[model samples]
Target: MKGFTSYAIKNLKSTGSIARSSKFLARNLAKQVPTDAKTIVELGAGDGIITRELLKYMPQQAHLTSYEISEELLALLQRIDHPRFSLKHSSAMDIVQDFAIDSVDCLVSCLPLALFPLEMKHELLTHIRSVLKPNGLFLQYQYWLSDKQLIKEYFPHLKTNWVPLNLPPSFVYTGTAPNSELVAE
Candidate 1:
């Protein structure tokens, strides 16, 4: 299996809380983000691992905006230099106010939900839903299954699938807003 170099993997491993997803997991997560999404936002884009995969499959006209808290990682993404890609060196919570409500086409995340405080997790979901278009999709991957209930509570139309091909396995959860009018209104 192709894997990140030892040094790269080591950095991820040392993070303790942040899991550096395997390439398989990254590809699977990318697939969950709608390829046709006009304005896609990715949260916690560590090392641009999933960012690269998302770019590979995204529509040419799609605009991909990725937010990463790590300055080092943001620097790496800057080197990619794709016209369709924008890297933001900021935390997700810090930028939610920047976009208008109900304007996002899709939101994809590689953040470690389990590591977040319960209140923060809920607030993030609520904010994400508020900004997403009515028919918008929220795609997230986790290393464990415990967060399923939390996700379901916020996204009633949640759908989940497992990908065992990844190291230590992973689960992809997709939440679709029920109706465009209801979401935007």
Candidate 2:
């Protein structure tokens, strides 16, 4: 995955993981996805590493839509040619406008939240909350725990786990979009 490293260096601010270390693959996705998930979304799907892993574990009938803002990565992702995959050239915040509300069952993100400006992170989470089905899952990994409080703001019921096998290690944050009525007036 030389191309992946090159892209990561060139887009350090946008790229989070040093590499898609195989060690985290099982822990990242295997047990998280519900067996019946119909519609899943992936944010910051760089070079489709996690995207491909997600596909391998997803139920055959489930469809996954991955969003990548970088055209360079999007080109590589589009070539995967999976029948259940849909690649979107957009930012995570655009999901609300790009898809129907309450339509997504799960969202796995590789976004570098700690590197983002506070407002952009907040705005993205707002849109994420809007598009997810009630109690939908948002699984994300970061190299640091600084964003723990930020994630808690958007997803109240949250837990974190550590995966040391990855380069530089990583923390996996699992959260659920609160049931819609709980957040509504």
Best TM-score among the predictions, by candidate number: 2
Pick the lDDT winner: 2
C-alpha lDDT of residue 158 in model 1: 86
The root-mean-square deviation over C-alpha atoms between each candidate and the true structure, in angstroms, is 4.0, 2.2
Clash total of candidate 2: 0
Task: State TM-scores per candidate.
Answer: 0.85, 0.91
**Cα lDDT of model 2 by residue, 1-185, tens digit:** 35887778777777865565454754476468878889999888888778888888998779999999988888888888889999889888889988788888888988888898988888888888878888888888888899988888888888999888777788888889887543421
lDDT of 1 by residue, 97-161 (tens): 76788888888977778777898888888778877888789898876888888887767788888
- Give the lDDT of residue 128 in candidate 2: 82
Which parts of model 1 have CA positions greater than 4 angstroms off? 1-19, 180-185
